[model samples]
Target: MFVSKLFGGRASDTFITRNSGLISHLIPGDQVLADRGFTITDVLPPGVTLAIPAFTRGCKELPEHEVTRTRRLANVRIHVERAIRRLKGFKILSNIIPGRIQHVDDIVTICAGLCNLQPQLIREEIEGKASDLDEDEHIDEQQEGDEYSWDMAEDIEGNHLF
Candidate 1:
């Protein structure tokens, strides 16, 4: 969520609140792929098939397909994070704006839409190079595990912590 804010991605306190009046555009079984900010609710249409890392906290045993789909969704979600990081490369998105917090939402969405219109900033060419990885991208990764591919290095202590 931090990377999204830094990259001009939308920031509503509750995603469900922000998505209010927006979910109407989507149909049933749309394969919703979202971050953990979204609450799992039965109110959503049946067969929607939400693909998010299950953070049910000590809940025993999930369906095999849920685990498999979550993994696949995780891989694809990286590109979205990359896109947000690319947006944050611009300075306007980095700074916090005063006045309306509501405007912040608009700014983020506008910047994202604008970013979509722009060309690729970081071309995927050579390997063995740094990635435009965002800090928020690994939140889910860390939710399940203390480690992540997105970790830059040690945290405070020099013990190679994630």
Candidate 2:
């Protein structure tokens, strides 16, 4: 199920994430997959993790493990981007109706429902191929076991650490 909230265009992603009540629904150990723009690590409830692509900072290149993790994250993030694209496809969402501003939440919920009624976003065959790649890479058991963790931390300077 999809949960959504309507916020003004000027609202920051971190603000919306913290105030939208979405965090309340998450439990300890829940991992939130998000884009680099979502810098709400400090606001996340205790034990809840956030995962985003690794930043190279001033380094010449990211380590091999970071590269692999980033590739996996990007592959999964593609589906999320596609879902947003589908949501935007609705003409009602293209232009705001001043008169229906109060009902924007309902409209978004209905549109999300309609999108859910469509075919599965990722097919089983494609998923199998991804697993095949992982096997070919000979991923370690420890990394495989922590696949769902996606632990991310922020340093004292607010820079994200993988």
Candidate 3:
């Protein structure tokens, strides 16, 4: 899931419309929870449910189709809020960012990857993932097999060996 801050109005709308071309991967029941910022007026791709808040500028009464779309998107939007809270768990992100806005894009991506790598959040699911580990352990395990892997080739403190 990604949230990019594009220019307001048509630019923002265009960015969302184009990027959602990847919606083919999403199956029915899979949902997209977006902020009011991502509220799109047009139809979305099939099988990708969207949950966006009401568009303030539009009339108070939304047509049936619009109401259904907004509700579907809202159900997913709650999860996006949860995700944002989780990301803010890291001090670097929570604190005022120091650099130019241009740098934020890379920082956000790197932070997301790091967050995804963290095991603490997976503690409850780690046991369930044991079977998953076994399936690809030959290629993915570090301490067990894959000594030549990039991860194992470096120290925890990132001291380079080669």
Best candidate, TM-score-wise?
A: 2
Ranking by TM-score: 2, 1, 3
**Higher-lDDT candidate among 1 and 3?**
1
lDDT tens string, model 1, 64-138?
A: 756544544454455455555655666665776666565776777676676655544323331112222332333
Q: How well does candidate 3 match the true structure in TM-score terms? A: 0.40
List, residue by residue over 1-162, the lDDT tens digit for candidate 3.
343433445565547565645444445544444556665425545544554456647577877656554554333333334445555666666654575456665666666666445433212333221223322232222231211211111111122111
Which pairs clash inside model 1?
none
Off by over 4 Å in 1: 1-19, 35-38, 54-68, 97-105, 119-162
Rank candidates by lDDT, best first.
2, 1, 3
lDDT agreement of model 1 with the native: 0.44
Whole-model lDDT per candidate:
0.44, 0.62, 0.42
Candidates in order: C-alpha RMSD to true structure = 12.4, 9.4, 14.5
Q: What is the TM-score of each candidate against the true structure?
A: 0.46, 0.72, 0.40
**Minimal lDDT window, size 10, model 3:** 147-156
Model 3, residue 132: C-alpha shift (Å): 24
